[model samples]
Target: MESVVIFDSPGKGRGLKAAKEFWAGDVIFSEASIAAVVFDSLAERICHSCFRRQEKLQRCAQCKFAHYCDRTCQRAAWPEHKVECGAIKAYGKVPNENIRLVARVLWRLDKEGSMVSDMQLTTLDELEDHINDMQEHDLKELKVDVHNFLDYWPRTSKQHLIDDISHIFGVINCNGFSVSDQKGLQAVGVGLFPNLCLVNHDCWPNCTVILNHGNQSAVSTVFHSQQRIELRSLGKIAEGEELTVSYVDYLNLSEERRRLLKTQYYFDCTCEHCKNKTHDDVKMGGKEVDGVKPSDEQVKEATDYCFQMMDKMDKARLNGDYHEVSKICRDCIEKTEPILADTHIYLLRMWSTMSEVKAYLQNFEEAAEYARKMVDGYMKLYHPNNPALGMAAMRAGVTHWQAGLIEIGHGMICKAYAILMVTHGPTHPITKDLEAMRVQTEMELRMFKENEYVYYSMREAALKNKPMTMLHEPRSVEEGIKNLFHRK
Candidate 1:
């Protein structure tokens, strides 16, 4: 609580304010969900109680609604599940995640309990709810669902149903965060973290959220037999500055990011990153707009071209036509690169796809180049230590090694491993996989280094009488060896 405060952010409405300056990687705070519901589609793989990926799970004998890792988790989750179980059973089918989430929210406001103060139901009352903005059919569906959830058939009061239900659903819509694992690769569930929700949206956020769903405990804390969502500073934050996180993924052009924010959160973003025209630069698009900014015409042209290329890439990928995808991706890159800069969100995906395609095709040198670009793009767009950037770094390292740049590849792997270690911890699958890569890279680096000295010495001996070579003119064997050493 001392780390942050809540106040009017003017154009942004209520926003969380930093109480003091904080550095990158600093933990602002951590809290578990107040009322989280694992989406039905993912429930089979993700635990209902702790949200961990479970292999050996047992169903609640009575309700058969949730699968838990063991008796302990089942018992721990019983209190919350008891009423929800009955509600779903009464519904005669599995309630969709939205309905279940709203039900849980209503229950918490009415009866559900939590172990943490920040997660208390009272903190949620002041949250924003866009009842007046909702569509007619959506409002009607929510009303019916709320009525069913609250068992309104037996109630005498009917006047407040529409208003109350709409308000609650609105709150959830505005504040709920789609939960993902530490790496943000899998959709696990959704939750209303009242305090985290208080942090306003910014296209270029100064903070990041990571959900830790592990059996291991933090150094100063016990692994609460539940999932934990931790918010950390992405970079240094000054006192009184508003703390913000991106509501939508930042790997999109300005227009797409705005579209997503408007559609999902129902708000217009005017953050500095959004206000800036050139977030990423254009190479040949009308008068270098500096960074990623393009003129209106350039924006439209790049947007249209990107969409067209994306459609082709998607269709080719779905059809398992890797060669077509690779070809189209290269065309997209070449076509867009001169007009669109590396910072363009479209290029990010293009570079990522190219890296994967080349890697699959065993064109290691080309794959390494694309992977490096992917890492560079992510580093520019994402917060420090983002899992995506870390993964990209690992990808670059592996491909660079495959391309015979062992020492450079090892260095990249080490960098990626360090970032992953801090963000994802030692036990996460991605972290462990990166750890394995780091070890292999180190082994290769050692072997390569060991041979390099002797090989270079022999080459030097043989080339002592030979002339040095220019970039284009290899005068002797020494020139070729030098070129190889420099990766020319």
Candidate 2:
């Protein structure tokens, strides 16, 4: 907040602008969550205080709902949980993430007495709800949530009018940021950071938002660090330049991106890419095969088929049927590869899914191959310093290393490190891990080059008694799919 000033952005509403020049990787600002809650579905898995996922968590004995990693985390979350514990028990079930979030915000507002502080740029009342812009179906769903929220609200607590409650829900719908886990991989919750909401969207943005789960060794620090976020410059920005981050994934074709933005955020994108349909050709490129080129109509037909396949794939994924998801991806790729270019969005999606599923199934060589293809397409489609590109490259690099392609693994890890240094900064846990990986891969490459025979002999001997599943965990595959599909 100190590094940037809130100002009226042209075309866009209010935006955060740089107060001074910022070099690539410089942190523009960092803010802790005003109010946050883990998704109910993940309540048991993720610590309520630190937002870290664990295999075993200590359940709050009193509430019998909230979970934490240790007494330290439990103590840290008590302030937030204290208000809702009795209400949740009386209500007989934990409300969904949305209702719980709304409750958290209300309780916090009651305690704080004011929504905006002296240094705050906007008040909670000032944040747009876009309720009027919501479609009929969405409004109906919101109404249901409001009803549930009212039922879940405790009678002794301060009450709010239905209109005000509904407005808060709309505001959250329009402004909430997806909070990621400690590794900046899987999304675990949703949070509201007021200053972050002031930033505007751009197809080609100059800033990236990272959910920073702080140092874990220091329990007190981790407690204080829950749901914190840092906004970093994607590249150089001069004084007074507006800081923007993409609300939607910019790698999608311009039309699809705009459609998503308009549908979700209630804004028509008029960014340069949207205005000019820039990179649409490359996104939707098609090629001829066996002296037969797909006509426009054929490509359109294939694209439609791919969309249907994607829906099925999504359902299978959500159902936790990785085998079915892999089958769908392979079938779609076989049908669309000839008619659609390898760079097509649908093709890339399939390649990404195939890679993760293959990795999950322990087919490392095939996983590495598909991951490499997905990373190559991402390189062509995303900004050179895009965080997503860096993440994908890191995944590909790890898959390659697991598959025993040392030279290629070293190269990809180095590439990922360079990109992440710009997008995630060197201090981020993911970037730090990538740096460690790069060092390991580099050493392995040198060893392999010096004596390929000796290197293989030693490596084989070392791994002979080790479990085949030890190279990569299934969670990594889960993280890959979650990161690609979920927003943050």
Candidate 3:
């Protein structure tokens, strides 16, 4: 429990504070989840083409396992299934629910395995042990639904599937469960781990964790890294403070947010925002009116004003209002800055937006500077291979090119292209954009060199035709050309 209490961040209804002082840029925690799934077992029982389970189904010729109802469903699913078929066949047995859940969690960890480490796996093992010690009622309740779900399936010729699946459930019972009729909600994927999950919730969390689709894997990636994988403070934490993170989007209304956190995370938030709405209401009132206490309508107006301002900022660039875009973006930064720290995602967006606007306004130098900051912010929030980071790198490269720094521009663009190629692949629109920019930059550099050569030749001709003067500024045509070329 003490290990889980890594930070003290007080706000909204819950706070996340540092259990120990963490240096900047450390990977506080990382867990993997499943990114993709092939419900082959489910497919075996359903139409592969329509993804609708049925008692009888026909198998596709390409991969004999893909059961389809008709040619239409088969044709529709061909694009997605073609590539996945080989991999699915290779996986051999469909993993048991527990193994499947674990695999799913692992898949959620980004495709890049940079944040993963041996220590995280050990922590997962510890969680398994802890769950095993739960009350008998809890264990029974958790497993009953899962066992029943398996019962519905026709008995497979392979008994190993049932045995393997049962073994997985045994592991899950040791952890925890939320059961429904069709499936048992295992604790492994529910965002719980004594040390990792102990970190409290915040409306404005300093860090974020993305659970891969299907809840197979999770990675708690810092939006910023000042240090390596050491536990650090989100803000300031007292010795005994309970560290929290905003499990849901804090930008939503407090009531809605509280309900989500409670329902999903099982914590009743008493964070500052929920506790002191009066103070927040008053502060909001001050934004709209002089010092007068705002009426309910006035409060709503003020809230709407801030929300609309943010919305306007979001669309300003699309609408082609550069000046308003910049102004509104900056205004948002100013207003949100106090409530949301620099590491907040919203703040990072504001910084990036400002950088983009600067670039569009032809302030290349400033744009480049802001672009660097945006890159840093993105790197902190996302893994190195994230498309957003690649996009930011491309923007920075463009700014460098605009400022007449050819080498740096080329390097930045090349880096952007490389990363984009990996994350989104060559055919992605962004990858194509970066590739086009690279070509354009190369062409401009070649033309610039050619222009330099032409200018030098003209200068040489002028020097050669000049007559001798008292100042000793005279030369033959050949000498003049040589001198001008030499000077260049």
Candidate 4:
């Protein structure tokens, strides 16, 4: 039987369809790719100034990782090396080639580099040709712009940096890293796999890809004779639809998503949300009875007005004007609502913004409800493993706690912690925050229990002070105090 097959998904984009219908949660295909080109732990011992993994390291004065055998190597590599040194220190590790691929692509695109000098049609053709020649594994690796670096391998010493980058891509193209669980977060490596990449863009996605890391180099594959890993539909998808996954947090606005997609992938999207012509030309409190044609100038004015409103909303958020932010977000939504439906990513963001606004206004119950709805919708699209899902879960928990729903708060917090622990591992910053919240909640529960006991004890003492005594002898105040202290 064929391992995988590609075909058109009904009304969705092109998708990898199953050659044979498989059961739910089946592994469609699994390929491992290297997670990191350079390990952070190893880099610390080596000269961070250059890509030399060393021991007995001498640290660079400019950055923490710029360790050198002596001042000579440091000085020698400084001109080409110093630029990335501080970045490495800030990130605390060198990113692998895959990450570099995305970074390089973005950097070059932003700088208008010659790499993508060709027009969009030509670039698309080149990409399609490259995909046609690739094996399943190669195709998967090629999905991310970073994996494209694999095609530029076999570099000469004259282009050492170029060669290094190419090799990094090649390594990550074949290997997958194991994420480490420290504290509450996971450590991620640069190599994002190709199969995962082909999962197209959705404002909401069904499955979430997680990273795993450890200190060993091992690769293993498990195949089932009776069952296969299946890409179960998160929502209904007709035959031949493009199976998509959200690359960014779907909780973000359409503008944010569009900007990221254009900057990262060099595509001008005409997605359902972006092509809302009617909504884009509408105004607040202005009525069009559906028969009047808007003038070109009117359309331009509406477009410019939307942009202006977005700019103002951004400024209001940055300036800490929660009230203005709330009002502006509402205005944007009210204006856009008649044109854009609820499924638009911007609408989802508006809901999130509304939740934030309500929270800021001390309307915890309403805020919590709105956050819960957002989380529910996000979970449907991205599943529980995505970081955005975890964040929504965390926010939902916080809102519940604020609203005095202790049981619900605990449940949400626990769920968030569990999801974050797997995706980010135990050592990630977000995981640490979740861990702290969990501990704090548990402590609060304990304190509440203690306070209840104290209240009961004091009430009993007050009743006894009224000279009411049972047939049995009553305990003295000293004895009672001792007993209460010793109960635990």
Please write out the lDDT profile of model 3 over residues 251-362, one tens digit for every residue: 3346766776554444467766766542233223332224444356644544555567768886766688889988987777666544443334445556766776776676
lDDT of 1 at 44: 72
Q: How close is candidate 4 to the true structure, as a TM-score?
A: 0.42
For every model shown, the clashing-pair count is: 8, 0, 69, 45
Cα lDDT of candidate 4 equals 0.47
TM-score of 2: 0.91
Provide the lowest-lDDT 10-residue window in model 2: 479-488
In model 1, the Cα lDDT at residue 132 comes to: 72
The 10-residue segment with the lowest total lDDT in model 4: 479-488
Q: What's each prediction's TM-score?
A: 0.76, 0.91, 0.34, 0.42
Give the range of the ten consecutive residues with the poorest summed lDDT in model 3: 479-488
The local distance difference test score of each candidate is 0.67, 0.82, 0.46, 0.47
TM-score of 3: 0.34
Which is the better candidate, 2 or 3, if ranked by lDDT? 2
User: What is candidate 4's lDDT per residue for 1-488, written digit by digit as tens?
Assistant: 14445555554344555455443233344433311223444455444322333457677776564466566556654644444555555555555434543343323333443234221111111121222334576545445434333333212212224433434334333222322222212221233233443445555444334432221111211221111112333333443345454445444455666776554443455566555532332222222446554455554454455567768877888788889977886787667545443334444556677676777677777777767766765564544455556666777787776665556767788888887665445644556777887887776566556785764465457546763221111111111111100000
Candidate 1 lDDT by residue in tens digits, 1-84:
778887989998878889999887777877776688877777777768767666677887666778877766676677878877
Clashing residue pairs in candidate 2, if any? Answer: none
In candidate 3 the C-alpha lDDT for residue 488 amounts to 3
Clashing pairs in 1: 277-293, 278-292, 278-293, 279-292, 280-291, 280-292, 281-291, 281-292
Where model 4 places Cα greater than 4 Å from the true spot, the runs are 1-206, 213-244, 247-309, 320-347, 357-366, 376-390, 410-488
